[model samples]
Target: MDFQLSEQHEMLRKAIREFAEKEIAPLVEKMEETGEFPLEIRQKMGAVGLCGLVTSPEYGGNGMGFLARAIGIEEVSRVCAGLGIALQVHHMCCWPLETWGTEEQKKKYLPRLASGETFGVCSITEPSGGSDPMGMQTEARLEGDYWIVNGRKCFATNSHVSDIMIIVAKTGTDPKGRPAFSAFIVEPDFEGFSLGREEKKMGFKGASSGELVFNDCKVPKENLLGKEGEGLKIALATVNRVGRPGMASIGVGICYASLEEASKFAKERVLGGKPIANLQAIQFMLADMFALAEAARILNYRANWMMDQGMNCDTEMTLAKYVATENAFQCARLACEIHGGYSCISEYAVQRFLRDAWVAIPSGGTSQIAKIVLGRHVTKNF
Candidate 1:
């Protein structure tokens, strides 16, 4: 298999890096201060085609596919992970729509999503749990031309900022005595659908995370995604296919940022009339950071490739997410040690990177969840 990135990929990476450094960097300070993502930046991302990467051009997207998306997320995340995750969750809305929505549904929503006229969300987590679909308390029942939705979604990224969203809820009981879930398209303006309190997080401050309350929310019958009893399947596929890999790429970006900052500080910081780059201890830390970043990047790249190839890469992506997120935290801590007390200063990006890294570990799925997945995969396959 070829390991080299294509010319298009190289050009795309360079262009995105330039865009992030110039367009997204300056506003990061305001976002960090206010804990709010700028609509201005989101619109800019739409204009530049980041919002269209995973969608088809026939539906107003560039259709750059999955690897391109990973590259985009990695670059943007290298600058600001909060923005990266916001966009990543936004991207989550596209995949399921493209994969399952009817042509009419696609025509109605994809253009708005592609143009950033509407921010999209996949609201799957709830107060009960995130990884368990059957445990969700959200319920939807069809009545005449519409469905009534009731329950609450918590920890939903892009919660307050979203215009369009996909929500999963228990619709009925299956023959096996298990809860049957269904996916539906929900709009914020719909009656009985209201925003709950916004969360102030320790990291990833630029994006919004909060609760989505559904109290007999009325949803049109046409908005049912795929079919009844398909919500669990759709939710799992979206998380495994898009969510984990996207978060893993963010972790890769954090690794890159940590390594870059640590290396720079080690070179510039002076001690005993010499640069700390000459110190053995500093050198070892830098070396470990380098190794972690490289390994994490490779895992992300490989998983992205497998996904683009239409291979069953759930296990691979899960592994990638675990490694990259854990390594990201390690890299950030090492960078912090290199920065000494200055690391805690808000002026330094290292603290932000450290916080972002910590958040990434649990964002896609926690390390314990990943271990369980890996255990199941190995036991079945081997």
Candidate 2:
């Protein structure tokens, strides 16, 4: 694989970096203080093409593909991971729709999503179903011209801000007693659909992480995504491609941030009348941080590049998510240690990076789960 990024990608990176530094940086202080993201930022992102990366131009989307999307996410994340996460989740909401929705569904929703007229969310996690698809308690029953959906979806990002949602619920039991699932393009105006208690998370604070409550929510029959009993398939594919790559992008951004923070501190911080950069210990730490950051980036970029090439890289994406997130955590912790007592204080950005790193592990599915998938791949292939 060519290690060099295309001129288009480089230019894209420069554009995003400039936008994030100019627009997003000014808002980070407020978002960190209030845990409330500005809706205006989403609008601005759409204007800059961040919101339409995954979409086709036929539907008012840029259709740039995954690698470009990852770069955009990573650059945005380098300044504020929370906003980056919100953008990524918005793309996640777009993925199944474009991949599975009817042309009419595309025409109706894609333009709205592409333009950031409203945020889009994919809500599937439930109190009963942490990782197991069959454990989903959200049930949908087909009625005349609609489906009645009833249950709570937890940890749904953009819960408050989103007007469009890709909702997954169990529709029936299969012949083998497995819970069959279906996906829907639900709107906030749908009857019985409401926002539940918002979660006060330790990280990704301003992403509006919360619950999606559907109490006999009525969705039109035409809004169903893909074939019947394909919700699990849709969910899995989205998670494998859009979800995991997003996590990796955030991880890579954090890793790079950690490296920058650590390198700067080591160079400027004084110990025994000399800058800590004079010490071999500090040098080694910086070296490791740099190496790991680059490694994570290479892994994540390779996975997304493979995806853009139309290859099924489930195992590769899983590994990239695992390594990138875990390395991010480790690197952030090291950066924190380099900050010494200063790291514990809220004033330091490294502390925030550490918190966000921990949250990243569980966002796209936990690191433990990634290991299981990778372990299975190892056993099956090796």
Candidate 3:
């Protein structure tokens, strides 16, 4: 198997890396401190086609493959994780529509989303149900030509600023008396749709997280994302295919940044009348970090290639997300150790990288959940 990136992919990666360093790196500290999403930067990202890397060219996107998307995400994340997450949310919201929406639905939504004229958020987790989306309590009852939705969703990313939301709601009753769920595209201005309080998160502070309250919100029948009783299945399948790669790329970016910072510091810091780089212990730690980062990059890109080939890569994707994120967290922690007192300071980026690294283990799915998924695949159990 060839592990080298194609020339086109390399060009795209370098372009995005340059763009990220020029535009995103400068403002990240301010955005983090103020907890504000930089709309200007987001718009710039759209102009550069970073916001729609996986979308079709007919819809004003670049029509790139998943590998290109992964590269774009990794480069952007290396500079600013919060900005990277905002783009990830945008891509995730657009993906389900592209995969399952009707032609009319695509015509209506894809262009706007692709051009970044309209931003989107996905609402699946709720106050009561997070990892287990099948346990969602949100319900959408048919009323004439509309569906009346009533429920509350918490920990929703990009909820406050998004123009559209892909909402999951129960639509039917199963034989077992469980609620059958469906997905819908709801406008932020829909009646009875309101934004709840914003969550002050531990990291990725510039990316907004908040609650979405839908109380008797009436959505047209045409807004349904897919067929009834398919919401949970669709969500699961889409996340497995799209979400894991996005997250894995973030881990790669974080690990790269952490190791780069640590190496630079180690080479510069003097101890016992010599540069720390001369110390065997420092060299070993940096070597380990470099090895882990390279491994993560390989796994992440391999999973992206598997997705492009239309393989059933659930196990591989989960493994990539799990191992890459754990490696990233360890690298960040080690970078902090290398930085010593300077790492803990707000002015230094290591502290923020460490904080952001913590979110990766739980975002796409927890490490524990990934283990269970791999176990089921290996055992072939129900």
The C-alpha stretches of model 2 lying farther than 4 A from their native spots are: none
Please report, as a residue range, the 10-residue window in candidate 1 with the lowest summed lDDT. Answer: 36-45
Clashing pairs in 2: none
Which 10 consecutive positions of candidate 2 have the poorest summed lDDT?
Answer: 127-136
Off by over 4 Å in 1: none
TM-score of each: 0.99, 0.98, 0.97
The residue-by-residue lDDT of candidate 3 on 1-382, one tens digit each, is 7888889999999899999999898889888889887777767888878878878987777778788888898998888877777777788888898888888888888888888776778778898867888789999999998999999998787887788789899898778998789999999888888999998888887888899999999899999998888798778876787777778888889999999999999989999989998999988899989998999988888888887787877778888888888888998998998999999899889998898889877887888888888888879954
What is the per-residue lDDT of model 1 for residues 204-294, given as tens digits with 9 covering 90 to 100? 9979999999999999999999989999999999999999999999999999999999999999999999999999999999999999999
- Residue 145, model 1, lDDT: 90
Local distance difference test values of all predictions, in order: 0.92, 0.91, 0.85
The per-prediction tally of clashing pairs is 0, 0, 0
Leading candidate by lDDT: 1
Output candidate 1 Cα RMSD.
0.8
